[model samples]
Target: MATEQKILIIEDDTFINRIYKRVFSLSGFGIELAQNGEEAMAKMESMNPAPTLIILDIMIPKISGFEVLKRLKGDVRWQKIPVIVMTNLSEKTDEEKALNLGASLYLVKSDHNPREVVLKAKELIDKQIV
Candidate 1:
């Protein structure tokens, strides 16, 4: 079913954002891009339907992704949304921290390509639908 589901991508690298936008777009997902936590918060505030999924990078300028994630999970409006923390932070502690902060999943950037990330996101979204 093609719903109005969209994906919000929070990444500092323009190149990575482009790649993700292309892949997710090809897969029929609407994409919103934010370069940092501040932009992300602003985007979230202005968004109408609220994104179904958020892909976040933990190490961004202005504000950290952990802080963003915490705010998202704490807010009643966005609390139920699923977040995927996709970063190069490969430390087990980092993954644990993301999960502890209520991320639905944590991914190491080098470990998954854009298409794979899309697949994982689709899977997570499907689970939410069920």
Candidate 2:
């Protein structure tokens, strides 16, 4: 069998993080969790088989999602990883900023359920079109 696709979620909210883990688990996706940008960076560096996708929250405790996106985009090795910015911040500026920073997609947390987000993620991965 082909290996399961891995997904990394960079989120600070403990409750939401656990929920996403369960959701992705049931969907046959290997999952990794990072509470903040620092942890996320460390995880990314050590991931031998890098994750196929990343879901990043904009308002994190230690470092903002924007900063993380910038770092990932700035590095050639990590630049191709597809990133989805999942945030409750629905302002137009915030959405535009994330897209400008190389986020493949921007999702509003309040607007999408767990299932919806997972489906979207799968669609993105399947397309391979970003």
Candidate 3:
């Protein structure tokens, strides 16, 4: 069955965001894009159903992804939604920090292709359903 699951992508790179949007859409998930941290926060606040998952990049402008993750995990309304940190930062400390801040998973941008990322997202969403 087609899923009604929606994914919010918070990335500053237009090309990367488009790739994710296309991959996730083709995989039967709805998609939303936020070009910066401020826009991401606004979208999260205003989205009626919220998103089933969030794919975040740490280097986003206006606010860092770590801060966004902190807010999302801290808020009761959004804490349950899974967040995947997808970024070029492959440092061990960065990964540790993201996990400590409540990211469900962390994928280095160069380590996973768009399709692989989408598959992982699908798996996470499916788990949420159960």
Candidate 4:
């Protein structure tokens, strides 16, 4: 069997993080979690094989997800990693900022269920492989 793709979920909410972990794990993707932007950056830096996708939350502690996205897209080594901005903020400006900062997709948490998020992640990862 082919190895499962890894997904890094940067969310500060314990409940939401657990949901993502369970859903992705059940969907056969390897999972990593970061509760805040600082930890997310540290994890990304240390991971040998980078994650296939990143599900980021904008309201994270320490640094905002926008800053994280900016830094990731700025670094050549990590720039190509697909980032899906998932957060409670549903404003057009926030969405635009994320996309402008190089996020692959922006999703409002209330609009998407865990299954849908997992499916989207899979689709994005598949596209990357192609």
Candidate 5:
């Protein structure tokens, strides 16, 4: 039931968000969007049955994506939701930091093609479902 798979995307850029929404939709995944970390958290709190996965952007307004990841990892209910960190920041330190903070996949937006990113995300989600 891949179509039933719900994904939450927390990104500040409207263009990027639209791109992601289209990508996931094309892949038959149910997608939800949040403009900021705070809005993402609020949406998570109210999401029915929770989300299967989360696509997070490191640099965002209101609250940084790292803070959101930290909070999600701390909460038992949401801790199990696999997070794919998608950011333009390609530093080794940043990637390590995100992994240590509980991100399941850390992807450099500038390095990977959109299809590759989507494939990696599907792999993570499939692993979790299995």
Candidate 6:
């Protein structure tokens, strides 16, 4: 088995967070959770060794996912880490916005099950494709 890669998942919905935690855990990923943008930023700063990847939600409270992506991509420390924008935003504009801001992948939540998301995440990390 590959060494488990850590992922910071920024999602505000309790049910969704729980689902992500469960799925990721089963897939051999270490998870760090944050409910809002402020918490996300703080977690990023405090996570020991940092996270290998990030799963971001756009409609989160405070800072907004777009802003979070901007901050992450702008910072030298987090720029190279892959970010997957798993959001409820389904419009082309939203997708473009996230991609423009440096999201490595954008997946609309309603279109994919949590397990599918986890699989995609694993592939992304394995390929080291940013």
lDDT of 1 by residue, 73-129 (tens): 999999889999999989999999999999999999889978898999999988988
Deviation in Å, model 4, residue 91 alpha carbon = 0.8
lDDT, model 6: 0.92
Predicted candidate 3 versus true structure: per-residue lDDT over 1-130, tens digit per residue: 5537788999999889988899999988888899999999999998878999999999999999999999999999999899999999989999999999999999999888788998888888879889
Residue pairs whose backbone atoms clash in candidate 4: none
Candidate 4's residue-wise lDDT over 1-130, tens digit each?
A: 2766888999999989999999999988888999988999999998868888999999999998999999999999999899999999999999999999999999999898889988888888779889
> Which lDDT values do the candidates have, in the order given?
0.93, 0.91, 0.92, 0.91, 0.91, 0.92
Q: Tens digit of lDDT per residue, candidate 6, span 43-82?
A: 9999888898999999999999999999999999999888
Extract clashing residue pairs from model 6.
none
What value does the lDDT take at residue 90 in candidate 6?
Answer: 91
Evaluated at residue 30, the lDDT of candidate 4 is 89
TM-score of 4: 0.96
- For 1-130, candidate 2 gives per-residue lDDT tens digits of 2877889999999988898889988899999999999999999999878888999998997878999999999999889888999999989999999999999999998888899989998888888744
Q: What is the C-alpha RMSD of each candidate to the true structure, in Å?
A: 1.0, 1.5, 1.2, 0.9, 1.3, 1.7
Order of the predicted models by TM-score, top scorer first:
4, 1, 3, 5, 2, 6
Q: TM-score for all predictions? A: 0.96, 0.94, 0.96, 0.96, 0.95, 0.94
lDDT of 2: 0.91
Better of 2 and 6 by lDDT: 6
Candidate 5 lDDT trough over 10 residues, lowest sum: 108-117
The C-alpha local distance difference test score for the whole of candidate 5 amounts to: 0.91
